[model samples]
Target: MIEAQGLFKRYGDKTAVNGISFTVHPGRVTGFLGPNGAGKSTTMRMIVGLDTPSAGSVSVNGRRYAEHRAPLREVGALLEAKAFHTKRSAYNHLRAMAATHGIPNSRVNEVIEMTGLGPVAKKRVGGFSMGMGQRLGIAVAMLGDPQTVILDEPVNGLDPEGVQWIRHLARGLAAEGRTVFLSSHLMSEMAMTADHLIVIGRGRIIADAPVSEILAGRGQLRTRVRTDRPSDLLAALRGDGTTSTFLEPDLLEITGPDPRRIAEAALRQQVLVYELTPLQASLEEAYMELTASEVEYSSHDLSLGPPAQGVSEGSRS
Candidate 1:
């Protein structure tokens, strides 16, 4: 497990990471999410001792990273995929890394096959494609059979199959009782891969919860109701906290009420309801709503002709 308490980082006058505390438990895939400039990379670097913390502490498996006798065997990290010698063959790169930890050549070959890098194991790192480079990086990270794994944007350049592979690999690691912490911008994939989420914005932690809880609390539940008597249904649903909007001549999108409530309201008004469908809140919607105010840089749509006074550009989206 990984635990951080009041972790902070500062560069002169600017604070990159505030006093944030969170725990990544074993047997789960914890996703770290944030907008650009949200200090995600800085925090990850701090965890592995790449960047020193300004005021707090972080530990992996109950000890600081540097305190581990064989750090690679305790925790594996892929903060940057291109952090290897470009001229060396993939196999040689892993061999060199394993040599530092006294890991055997047999273990090196095992990771190569496990990461699907066996075919190109003899190829130079510089000539590998982006997807291949990512695979090689993962192979290096797993070389020591670490109990904790950290990956940043693991699927950045992967194809569909490669994406699925990483998803299963992350879950598989967690199933084996290892701590798996990853960062990604792909909400759809995160929704499928992550069991929990740690959301940060502007150097501060915004949310840390289970995936289901976050979705339930962030976005409103909406229902789509289709009926020939749209007017009667609308009149029955018009009240405080209950709104109806007409999407088509016979289709109405109702908010602030569930499908059962809308159906009963329509029935009491003598309206004919042909369809009532509930729209569950998606992870994308929940993420956007939670981070709406925390985004540091936001683009404006000139077509909207300047946002209203005191309203943020992100909110307009």
Candidate 2:
């Protein structure tokens, strides 16, 4: 298990983490989510002792990370995918890391196969692709068979199959009563893999709860309505704090009102409703709502400027 109490990190005049306290228990995967410049990476670094905390404390497996005689056996971290020697082969790199902890040569080969890097095990690290580098990083993290695993953006450069493989690996580790702490920007995949989430914004924790609870709390129940007279059905729900969007000529996505309320409104207006399906809120929607005002850098659509006199649409390139 990983525990942080009032953890804080400061860089000169800027503060990265500000008194954030949370616990990651064993036997489940906990996702770390935040926007850019939200202090997620700094927190992860502090957990592994990469950067010293300005104040407060964090521990892995009931002890500080540095206090462990064999640190790899206590916690395995993959914070950077390309932290290996540029000229060393994948197999050689693992052998070197395992040597530091007196791990056997057999274990090196085992991790090479476990991470699906056997085919390219003899290749130089500098020539490897981003996906291959990620696989190597994971291989090193699992080399020690640690009780707690901490991964930062493990799926950043992976393909669909690789992504699925990492997801399974995380869940499989948790099933064995190990702690899995993962950080990623892919909400769709995170929703499928994580049992709980720790959301941070502006150097402070905004939410720390189970996935189901956050989803249920962040978004309201919405109903998808299909009818012959779309505008008429909308008119029936004039007030009552309801909002809607026209998906098609005969279809509308109604928000705020429940299915029963929408059905009653349509029936009263004789709108001839054909479909009234309830839509569950997705993780992406819930995340957006939670971090709506917490985003440090907001992006807006760039307005297109007029073309030059001699430039045509097809000739611009």
Candidate 3:
């Protein structure tokens, strides 16, 4: 497991991380999510002992990274794939890394196969495509067969196939009871890969819980209700224990009441009901809603939502 206890970092007058604490447990994928410049990279660096915290500390497997015996065998991380020597072959790069811990060639080859880099293992990293470079970086991280893995944006330049491969690899690693701590800007990826989520914003921990719990805790639950007499249904739903908002004349968005209860109320009030589908905000939509203000850069003009149909003034992702 990886633990950050009140971790803090500062550079001159700017605080990059502000006393945030969280844990990454074994046997599950723990996704670290935040907007860019939210201190994610800084926190990961501190965890791996690349940067010393100004106020607190982080430890992996109950020991500081520098103090670990056989550190490579305990934790493997791909913090920055671009940090590797560009002239070195992918295999040679892994070979050099393995040599640091006296790991053998066989293990290097195993990771090569596991990462689907056999064909390009002998190619110089400088000439490899971005996807290939990402694969090579992953291969190096897995070289030590460590119990804990940390990957930052592992799928940054990957294709659909490569992304799928990484999803499977992360899941497989966790299935072996290893701790997987990763950070990604992709909400769809997080929704699919993570069993738990740690959401950070403005250098602060916003939410840390199981995926279901985080989603539930992050937003208010609303149910979509369609009835023949939408006005009556709205009136019936707005009471001591219920709240309703109108989305359309025939559809009323209701909350604070279960479907069964709403149905009973509608039936008792002679409101003909047709549809009642629970509404949930997609992870992407929820994340955008949560971090909209936290984003450091604005890609679109807020005043201009988007261009009209067949127009190209701005686009929304």
Q: What tens-digit string does per-residue lDDT give for candidate 1 at 45-94?
A: 99999999999999999999999999999998988678879999999999
What is the number of residue pairs that collide in model 3? Answer: 0
Where is model 1 more than 4 Å wrong at Cα? 228-231, 238-240, 246-250, 302-317
TM-score per candidate: 0.91, 0.89, 0.87
For model 3, the run of ten residues with the poorest summed lDDT = 308-317
Q: Name the lDDT value of residue 278 in candidate 2.
A: 98
The sequence of per-residue lDDT tens digits that candidate 2 reaches over residues 125-149 is 9999999999999999998999999
lDDT of 1 at 286: 85
What lDDT would candidate 1 get against the real structure?
0.89
Best by TM-score: 1
Question: Candidate 1: RMSD over Cα atoms?
Answer: 3.4
Candidate 1 lands at a TM-score of: 0.91
Give each model's clash number: 0, 0, 0
